[model samples]
Target: MSEIRRFAAEARGGTPENDNRRVKDSVKRLQATVVEFNYLRSDGGRVWESSPLLSTCRIDERSGSLQYNFPSGLRERLVEQALYSMISLRVQWEFDSKYGLVLYETLKRYADRDAAQPWWSVKTSELRDLLGCRDKLTDWKDFRRRALDPALEEIDRLAEFCVLVIETRQGRGRGGGQVVAVTFQIERKPKEVAAATIRELEKPKVQRRGERKAKAEDIASTVDARKALHFLTGADAGTRLKWVKRAEAMGIELPKTASVVENLARWVPQIAAALVAEERIR
Candidate 1:
């Protein structure tokens, strides 16, 4: 129960009673859920399966512990899987809606393609099914406005990939010339930008007012320092620091009054250029 509580981002910062209630509610939902699995075999065969998500679920109120088990067949298949997608829990928890979360996961499966322009396409109805809103949003405009558009917007902001709606419609459209299919192009972020995004997401979701302000200030200062370092040196701070240590070993010294960047600027120009070029090549 404690581990589950810790793993659930939403359970954090709530009272013990509230957390316990939330956990119980989640368990009930899991036990009651019937999931369908559609697997495509290597030889072009398809496997369709439906089963209860959980075979059993038990809770001990006094002990504050919970126990659950996946259906045996589901467990076996999961354990024997040869390939799987890795989803980041922090990113998943940051999604404000289930539509966004589902869309993000669906897109992530195609993120590793080696194609020059990676993309995923599906019939509008199929996408609606994937998002579990097949019958709910009957109108195309309502579906796109209320579900698809918002989901795509959230994914573009929070996900590692910048998704763009590259194509829609195949032939003459039906249903008042509605969009029949949708396609999205996925592009991965640069390393530095992705790293910064990860750092931002890693911060606690709930923070005191003062703490949040302080963190914002600290992050701003860090960004400023990085920009300053980049301006002063051809390479980033990390690359320059590596060579700074090498410079110190070679008997190059900095005055007490000078900062690391100032001394680096004053160092042998040829050596600095060489170091920067080497770092770039690496």
Candidate 2:
């Protein structure tokens, strides 16, 4: 239960009881969900199959543990194929909507392609199905306004890759042209920026906000100063020097290694608390 809450970014800030309720709701939804798969075999034969997402689910409130199993048929094929997407839970949890999350995953599938310009085009209907908004946002205008636009905004802001809307209209009619499809050009961020983004995501929510506040106040001269000491301990010499410089700039005298080691028990927790509150307002 604790692990589930930690990985589920949305649930991390909630109370234990609320988090448990949310987990129960998610488990129930998964148990009730049905999935369909269509496959083409090497001999040109086709197979269509359907099954519940989970065959069985059990939860023990007293033990605060949950157990579930996938449908047997799907489990066998999954084990045999071993095909899956490796998505970052941290990034996925940052998305504000399901559309953004789904679209991010869809684009991630093509992130490894060697093409100079990687893109994906999907029919409006097909996209609606992928986003699970087929029935709700039936109208193109409503769907684009409420779902597509917000999703694109979130993806561009939070994802490691940004999406460019290459095309959307096809036929000439009302509103300039009828919306028929969406084509997205996937552009990966620079290596350094992407690495920094990953590091930001890995931080605790409060610490991240604190760092942002510190930056906003211009209190820290170097970005490396905001990094926790533990992270710098394993970093290269240049990185460690930047942290030391940051401390010096803050009017703090550096203690020798022997003195620091002797006072570790007294100062470690205080250092952690200071880091958390350094950028706090009032």
TM-scores for every candidate against the unseen true structure: 0.59, 0.56
**Each model's C-alpha lDDT?**
0.72, 0.69
For residues 1-282, what per-residue lDDT tens digits would candidate 2 score against the true structure?
A: 776766574555544453477777888898889887755688989788889898778877778688999988889777763344577887887766889988988888776577787898888887898888978989887998999988997677577887888557767887768788879899898888788767767777567557657865565423223344444344466644554555556655566541243333333332333443553412
Top candidate on TM-score is 1
lDDT of 1: 0.72
Give per-residue CA lDDT, model 1, range 15-35, as digits (tens): 344357778788888878988
- When summed lDDT is taken over every stretch of 10 residues in candidate 2, the lowest stretch is 258-267
Question: For model 2, what is the C-alpha lDDT against the true structure?
Answer: 0.69
